[model samples]
Target: MLQHSAILGGGMGGMLAAFALAPHAEAVTVVEQDAFAGEPVPRRGAPQARHTHALVSGGARAMEALVPGVLAELAAAGAQHINLPGRYLGLASRGWFPRYAGRQFILGCSRELLESTLRGRLRELPNVTVLGRTEVVGLQGSPAGITGVRTGSAPLTAELVVDATGRRSRAPRWLTELGFPPVRESIVDPGIFYATRVFRAPVDAGPEFPAVTLQSSPRREPGVRRNGTLLPIEDGLWMITLSGGPGSRPGTDAEGFRAFAALLPHPVLAELIEAATPVGTPFGFRADANRRRHFERLRPCPNGFVALGDAYATFNPVYGHGMSAAALSALALRTEFERRRKPGTLRLQRAVAGAAANAWDMATGQDARYPGTAGPGPGRFDGIIDRLGDWISASSGRSRLVTDIRADIFALTAPPSRMRSPRVLWQAVRGGDNGPALPDPPFTAAERRVLGVRPR
Candidate 1:
């Protein structure tokens, strides 16, 4: 059994890994380059923190299981819980999803708040230590196994190491330096860009204000896609993010940002913010690709090391799956450690990868459908799956059952294969009565009154 564990990066994945390993190791250290001393604030390392982030039900459950009462703590911190379909104002590729009571839900908040809360909780663990402003320069040991990590000239020895340094992880380079063959990689870039700004919540807007999303449809236009979301975050602020794929990228300037929101399928997002006071200048981010490092496929893999979070894979943040996926990975790590009397590094690494598989497929599969998407295109089997997904999407806007299934998948509570079940398959094949497409935003009288707007 491992006596010491070191996790690189103090982000969600790394901190959670520390929690997972604390029970099995005598000492667990998280090496982060940022100081966690102030009120929850955005870190330079996580630029996209300013954008809208969703904590799906599956991830929320996993986190609650790990830390116990974390969800309640998050709620106390002003994170909003939005029930899927029931309280959401969403326009999907197919049509506006009908507002109905939902079984699944998502937590809406700034990334900074979520990470800070988690960090605070982690600090309470007696055996877990977070080393801030410490950069991991390299890994220690050979290609066969890692013994520790190198921080500049100093070496922190540990029996196990986890790489959660996100997209900037240098694990491949470090492994190559140790004479290991390069790991294969898969990348899919839809060239998605995001522009976000914060606005004071309108006077009438309340905690019950539904989160709004205008989803882009790849099937509608190959290279041109634009979407927007307005999430009510803490402190009576609405975080609005406008996004586009390739040809329709949003700009960083204020005017351009507003223009992008206006270009979405509906003008509700733009109109909502038209008279509202801006809290800050518009910020822009570019997530160039969804990249996966095939570490699980490595033969004779290193014995004492594994990669987690964005170190293993990064998805287009538009899907809002990253944080949740990290939580699931942490849960997987805990499970493997508990199940095995003596968990091998390779076995644990594979288990972590398995935890991330569903999210990877969900994000990349949809991104590949867009035109100008780089990297390997969908395979023959993937093409078949795409057709089925298209059918579901088109039908979901009309059929409540299909909509529920899609919502479940989006919340990460159900696998994509659930749609292939006999009942759902029969529904898909027989085609239910899909009501007419919504002509305008489906805001209720109360919601409209809160926004100070009338029904279109």
Candidate 2:
């Protein structure tokens, strides 16, 4: 049994890992490279914090379980809980998704606010301590078992160690130096670029305002593909993000950003923000590849060591699955630890990897089909799955049953297999009476009035 544990990184994943291990270990220490002891501001370590972030329902439930009342706390701090299918004015690959009162929802807020809230809650644990400004240099033991970690010339011995250091993790090099074979990695890059800007919401805009999205279709050809989203965040502010794949990369400049928004399938996003006040210059990010480290496949897996979060796998941020996947992995770790009499490190690591599998498939499966995507394309089986997925996506726009099932799958509330069930499959085959697709975004009059924008 492990008595002491150390987790690298202090973001949402690492903090949640600490929360999961706190009950089992006598001491849980988090080694973070950046100083996060102050207010909710963008840190150098997390540059992506400036962009938009959402906590899907699955992640919200895991977070609430890990730190009871976290969702309520976030809501109190101005995070908006927009119900899925009901409060979302979404444009799918086929057409607009109808608004129906649904059970699933997601939390919208700035990444900085989300991290700061988790960090604050973790601080209340008696046995947990976050060592900000500390960096982990290497491992202390051989490939057989990691006994501790090194911080420059200093060393902190631990019974267990977790790597939650995001995509830039050095675990591969550390494992190699420790005489372990290199872990296999899979990278699928779609050349997706994001240009994000924050705008002051209209005075009437509030929590009741529906979130809007215009998505690009991978099935379309002979044209640049792009997508846009407008989410209402804290303090009556709208965080708008424009994404382009390959040839249609969105620009970082203000003019280019506006142009990209204008070019989306619908002009609602641009029209809504035309008169709104810009918070700052638009920012751009391009490291949106889906990368996975196959640690579970390694032979003679090292004991007392495991990788979680982006260290294990990183998905495209456009899907908004990263944080939720991390939280789910943390929950898996906690469950394995509590259930087993003597939790083997390899077993726990595999469980964590299993938690990330569905998300990895959901993200990479979609990105691999986009034009100009690099890395090993999908296999024959994957190609078949992709085709089915495309059919489902197109059918979802027309069928409420398909849309609800998709919402559940995407929110991580249910397994992907649910879509393959007989009832859903039959629905997809028979197809429901969806009527004509909405010519414009299905924004309610009340929502339009709140945003101070007229219906198109």
For all predicted structures, in order, the TM-scores are 0.95, 0.95
Give the Cα lDDT of each candidate: 0.82, 0.83
- Residues 1-456, model 2: lDDT tens digits: 467899989988899999999998999989998996657888888888888887888888988888898888889999999889788888876678888888888898888878888988998999998888988999889867889999854688999889999989998899889999999999998888998999888765655787888877766443466888888888888899999887888879889998988888878888887756788999999856899998888766878889999999998888888999999999999999889855998898899888888888788777777757888876878767767866766554467787788788878877776777777777767754586456677877665654435322
Candidate of highest lDDT = 2
* Candidate 2: worst-modelled 10 consecutive residues by lDDT: 447-456
For residues 291-379, could you state the per-residue lDDT of candidate 1 as single tens digits? 88988777668878899989998888888888888889989999998998668888888888888877888888788887778878878
